[model samples]
Target: MSATLYYFDGRGKAEIVRLAMAAAKVPFTQVDIKEKQQFETLRAEGKLIFGQLPMVEYEGNHLVQSCSIARYFASKGNFLGSNEQERLKVDILFEGTRDFNTAFMPYGFLGFKEVLDNAKNTAMPRYLPIYNFILSRNGSNGHLVGSKLSLADLGLLEVILTIEELLGEDELKPYPEVQNFLKVMKSNEGLASYLRSDLRRRKNDERYVAEVKGVLY
Candidate 1:
């Protein structure tokens, strides 16, 4: 059976898993949690395990933690690495993306605009340049750890797309290396299709705010 994912209707933290699945060509189903009551019911049934979302039912296991779920899908798709050394590199870069994502997420009363601004200005400057350098060192070809795509690449793609949603596109114009890397990744057939599909979420606007608030409040 395909894995079952339970998360918010919008992307939020769960989109990485979807992207990983798409890259892996693995089909799965999802249960969209648009309200606090839906989340409560899942938690009441012990499906959430930690009373939190981004949970996946795969291989008879209930998995939570955004990074853990992303890792699971990425690993399933053989996107982790080809060897121990490559896996180590993937882990290092993936953790950085996790930290970058952690710096911005949902809080009912918290201003979404404030979070996006911090992510774009403070967080983007500190991380994007370093990532751009890493890409340039790797020939700016999009693969971060090896000749093939890995979890690190997927993580960075998500980060870049999120920034695009914030800046109305090409927010990484100053970071040419990273922007080039983005082009290479977007050229992938599977990823390109998913990007054009309806699965991708919208910008951090009122609709996003309402969805998050509905789930939290």
Candidate 2:
């Protein structure tokens, strides 16, 4: 394949691309930078689109930004939708997941308690109901947007898992439709295989958030 992903080999921001590729069975070169020396070399490279990680090099063109990469692969795999209306719905739901990640980043990734406290008190309560409403309204077929699997579905599952893993499981208990949606996504053959793959097993550890999971409401 001509596609190549250059990232630190973590699930933090690159896993969505990995997930999209896996779901579509599209193979690419996974260039992982783990050594500090290599990281420094790549970081000093001036050709980066935005001077950041998660940059995708495809067919000799380097694309920066995570969502752009996701959308590109989603389109390549025909995971967007069949029509413009459905495509807009896909965009809406995908943006919702992005909002969730941004809202929870300070708490989940940066360990910022002020932000985490506000998220638990305000953002969580607000978005939980909104997501549940979206799921109830559009996910009647147990899908996030349309009546089939799409990148939006994958994004929603990622947000749900991030919440359950980073915030707490109880965080999604009130959103039954979302919970059900995640269950389906988790059971997807490609997604399940990737989640259980040795690459994932060796890279992720849930123990870091054990204490947060215990205290999440």
Candidate 3:
């Protein structure tokens, strides 16, 4: 089946889907809409569902929403879960990470000192402990669901990376399980290669960061 992903040039909401597909060794095309006008054009043309990005076309099926896309690719790659119970567990953590993303996005985009401080003081304290507890409950195995890696782990890895970026690499020291979890996910050869690749590095450009800050601030 042919697969293509549409998102902004940066690694915002779409990173999880890309990571899942890459980890599963699924070859897919990534179309980066680098400008606001391009996105507006696509939306105006009714080419994007839900009037937003991070959409995917797989086997001729168009999917909207980032988490939905990630879950679909995860299922396709056999990284979702083995059974109903495991799937439920994976969904719980995945949704939790989504919630964390929703809460933390403003901090990243706003790019204000106060916003960063608020996230570090309020959001991180409130959310990180919950994730830490979940990881601990799962035997601190670096996998949020079951004994093996799943979509939940990939989602959490994204969350952890974002937190580290916003705060610092040392911020996760308070949550050792989460730190370990990040390490394990990053150690995956496919994921590591993708992380080190030009596609990932180019997303960190100053222009994109400035654009996000300009729009939100």
Candidate 4:
């Protein structure tokens, strides 16, 4: 399916789905909502089911919500897991990322050290250890579910990348298993290419930040 993702010029909530799509080796184009009017227009036209973005027009369906789009891509990519139990594990891990995303979104958009500090100090401690443990328990195999990669793995990479962008790359030093998982996943050709390409925004852009603040603030 030819997927068209609508979001801001930067990654925002769209990154995970993009990463998943990339990993799935599916081709999708980005429609950057660089202006407030652009998003407003889509909402006015009822293109957005929830009047919000990170929406994907895929296979003749307009998929709204960040996690829903990611889940769709995961399902299409066979990354949600191979079995019921494994899929549940994927959901669990993905939910952790979603939780962190909800909590840290303000800081991500505003670039506030105080907020980032609170999340890094409070939330990171609680979440990172569990991720580290999960990876470790799974033999630190870089896959949170079975032997192959899944949404859990992609979600972890997305979270780790965000932490790296805000807290610096060395932030994962305390959690070697999670850190190693990041390293191992980066070796995937699709993921690596996306990471190194302009298709993926590795760091939040100031202009995009201003646009998001202008619209949502």
- Clashing residue pairs for model 4: none
- Tell me which of candidates 2 and 4 scores higher on TM-score: 4
Residue pairs in clash, model 3: none
TM-score of 2: 0.80
Tens-place lDDT digits, model 2, residues 1-217: 6577877545657767777877776666667655555545665775465666677777777777888888888888888988999999898888887777676544434555665677778767877787788778874677867788888887877767767876678878888987888888888887888787754423233443442233221
Off by over 4 Å in 3: 201-206, 209-217
- Residue-level lDDT of model 4, residues 62-134, one tens digit each, is 8898888888788887998888999898899889877866556676455577778888778888889998988
- Per-residue CA lDDT of model 1 for 1-217, tens digit only, reads 5788887777778888888877876667788787888988888888877778789888899989878888877887799999999999999998888777665654223676677777777888889888888888887567888888898999888888777765656577888888788888899887898888876655456676687778877
Better of 2 and 3 by lDDT: 3
* Candidate 2, residue 211: how far the Cα is off, in Å: 22
Taking all chains together, each candidate's TM-score versus the true structure is 0.89, 0.80, 0.86, 0.92
Q: What global local distance difference test value does model 1 have?
A: 0.80
Give the per-residue Cα lDDT of candidate 2 at 141.
72
TM-score of model number 1: 0.89
Candidate that would win on TM-score: 4
lDDT of each: 0.80, 0.71, 0.77, 0.82
| Deviation from truth (RMSD, Å), model 2 | 5.9
Candidate 2 backbone overlaps, count: 0
Over 4 Å off, model 1: 106-109
